[model samples]
Target: MIAKSPLRVLVAPNAFKGTFSAFEVASAMAAGVRRALPEAQITCLPLADGGDGFRATLVAAGGGRTSRHRASGPLLEPVWARVGWLPGRSGETAVIELASVAGLARIARPSPHTAATASTRGLGELIRAGLRGGPAEILVGIGGSASTDGGAGLARALGYRLLRADGCEIPEGGLGLRQLHRIESDRVDRRLAGVRVLAASDVTNRLLGRRGAAAVYGPQKGADRATVAGLEAGLHRLAEVAGRDLGTSGLEARPGAGAAGGTGFGLLAFCGARLFPGADLVANACGLDGALAQADLVLTGEGRFDRETVPKHCAIVSIAQRAAPNGPGSPGAL
Candidate 1:
């Protein structure tokens, strides 16, 4: 940034972990800047890594609005999720966060078997509501999910069938996948025909294996050893069936396919959604590139700044990198 008077200052920051949201941080920073330099021009743009505060950040930056939609929770209870709506065709793009509707954070008194029985049905329902607007695209942030069902609940809620050997419908949840005999998709929604779905996540784990969704994220969802193994096996079965029936063979191994307890793979196989880095997705949606181009001074913040900041793909680091395209540790400048 130059030492000129009336400088253009862009304030962008992530949540301060457990303390304040990015918006709060930006507000305080802007207030302080105003007191110190009354003539300066300041803009506040709060950001997130497609997890906490995703809806607010994206909607505010993109000049959008938010609406509430009733949907099922991770445990099958009714809940209202806030979805961000941006200008689009019939629907240019709809933004949603899985955490808001069906996340572990909302679950109180989680049982030992929560991981096995949790579902992403509500997330699928949220998508259904967004489709009602006739949007050309749905941008979903698949983070903080409460299930490990590999998105079976999502597919099921979206009108796909998971049949057992006796031609009975398989129960929803990871444990239920053990009885999954085949997948039948004759009833899927037709509105999904040409609509595009983009999932924002930076998770690189695949759908099955040591580093896969089950083994890596299952424990965090309250899974025991046996439950983890069960979840893993269930995801494997889902992959096998999807590969054979939907011809989505080997997609389970795709990076990020295991995100959100394998909701990543579920979106891939069922909705044909593409996974993107959360920070990059947010930057693009909010037009951060344009903001950077016009700003003379930029500021980004978080709870802690360390070695893991950049590698973790936090929005704070995304701002820094875009501000300085030349290279390493040049984030403080453009």
Candidate 2:
């Protein structure tokens, strides 16, 4: 039976991968929902949980602006990465997504051995630049990275030194591990400590193992079978060094440890950041709960709804359902 009332509907959706942006998905869904309930008050909120489309999705959902920041790219080029700032009461917060700077998308075919050196150094520069303006908060989205250097490149850019046991500096990129040594973080930027760092990710793979970053994502980055094995071994050694130097263990199995290669572990270990679902952060920004409170119906969609799309991918369905009214004549769920 068709139910009629002065109903409120909320439409929030994530990206459908390479096809549509979250904003576009939400808009399309909202159109369909409005067609179903012509008189319903519909609120379209596009969301992202720190994946490839995080910045663009958030900028579209909220009144935000995108700016270009020069950063190190997957190939070590000085590339201009897209960063966004969402308007807030305590001034605007800069959304710096590592994917924008060091994402797998940026990696091209005919990749270079230097590609072996691809690092998150550019992401760190973008973060530092965002803070140069003294923004309220720095929200870092870590996902889709092309490098697997344990975020050593990022640490170096932030003023930490990756030194060999002989005190020589380590080169940038994952292959730099061939010159493995100790780590020196005494010179890391103190300003970073004063600001809040929030890491948004969905991966839970550790830093090293059969389930580690290299073994799982190496092929995606164009690593050959032998290269993968080498990277796996290197990561194990790196983790051991980290544990010995930092005096902490369990980084190898920490949820999101495999995010952006190994930057997830690096950020948690060094930056003192709290890791949360990319969807949760996006939900809070878009006020999904508040919209749901007023919503009688909900509609949503995503790029792919499959096994690989865990934690973050399910957010669309989950949030939409949670926001829908639970009554006999309440809105229909889709």
Candidate 3:
């Protein structure tokens, strides 16, 4: 009789929020697999979908270096954020995570007022700090943001002035967007000229209406019914003004515009950024597809399962679909 080959299992998982890191989750999964099948070969791949652990995962996969810089937090408070730098021929590729600077977790308390006042200034500051090194490209993992200010604060950090009708700078956060009059462009960051900014995210909503940023994400950020309405109006004003002045009119309608409380829209309007699926980006960077080809089974998961988690953009489902050869475009996984 011919001997059978041991089953090859690829164990991968995203971070479990407060419970455990992705690496820890993978380790636990690998241990369980070992107990179930002692002879099976297992490989652990910790995944990050542009959330809290994004920088670490990418750094390990790309063999990158890191630096720490003081930047504004989600509430505009100072925070020491880590920035990742990957090697390249002309210049280093800067990797930044929105969660590191403007994530909802940065906030200790959740309230309607704070939600309206959160800012993304830190993200833009990180980008500017990265440019100080003269990077070739910038990869921003934009999600888990606490701000709903339509990235006005991020624009502010990049040198654009969010002014009121009297030319005074507007306040911070989503509510402050209502007072936005015109955006001053002359002082906009000049370093953004040739840099390619890719906003890696999975959100598909636009910048306005029901599926837009405010309607979908405002509540999660602590907006009540009244606050949600206010945020919506503010975002509308911002979109119109940015369209007229920054020439980002139609980009607001594109998918992912609503991501991270309109941070995606802000990057698009101000930085000439392109949106990509975060999981796919990380998976490709780690060569998950190449490993998939050598595996007999792939096991993956995240912190929890929800309607959107399984059907839409959950990291586990993405890799599972990649492992399913019977499905179209299922040749690989991460």
How many clashes in each candidate? 2, 5, 0
- Tens digits of lDDT, candidate 3, 177-279: 9998999889977889889998888667788899889998888888899999999999999999998988888888989888889998999999999988888
Each model's TM-score?
A: 0.88, 0.85, 0.94
Give the best candidate by TM-score: 3
Q: Which numbered prediction scores highest in lDDT against the true structure?
A: 3
| Pairs with backbone N, CA or C atoms under 3 Å apart (clashes), candidate 3 | none
- Where is model 2 more than 4 Å wrong at Cα? 1-3, 6-8, 32-40, 59-67, 86-92, 110-115, 311-314, 320-333
Off by over 4 Å in 3: 326-334
> What is the per-residue lDDT of model 2 for residues 217-295, given as tens digits with 9 covering 90 to 100?
8877877777777677666766777778876577767878777778887787666667777777778777877777776
lDDT of 3 at 161: 90
**Best first by TM-score, ranked:** 3, 1, 2
Judge candidate 2 at residue 103 and give its lDDT.
Answer: 83
Q: After aligning candidate 1 to the native by TM-score, how far in Å is the CA of 209 from where it should be?
A: 1.8
Model 2 lDDT on a 0 to 1 scale? 0.75
Better of 1 and 2 by lDDT: 1
Lowest lDDT 10-residue stretch of candidate 3: 325-334
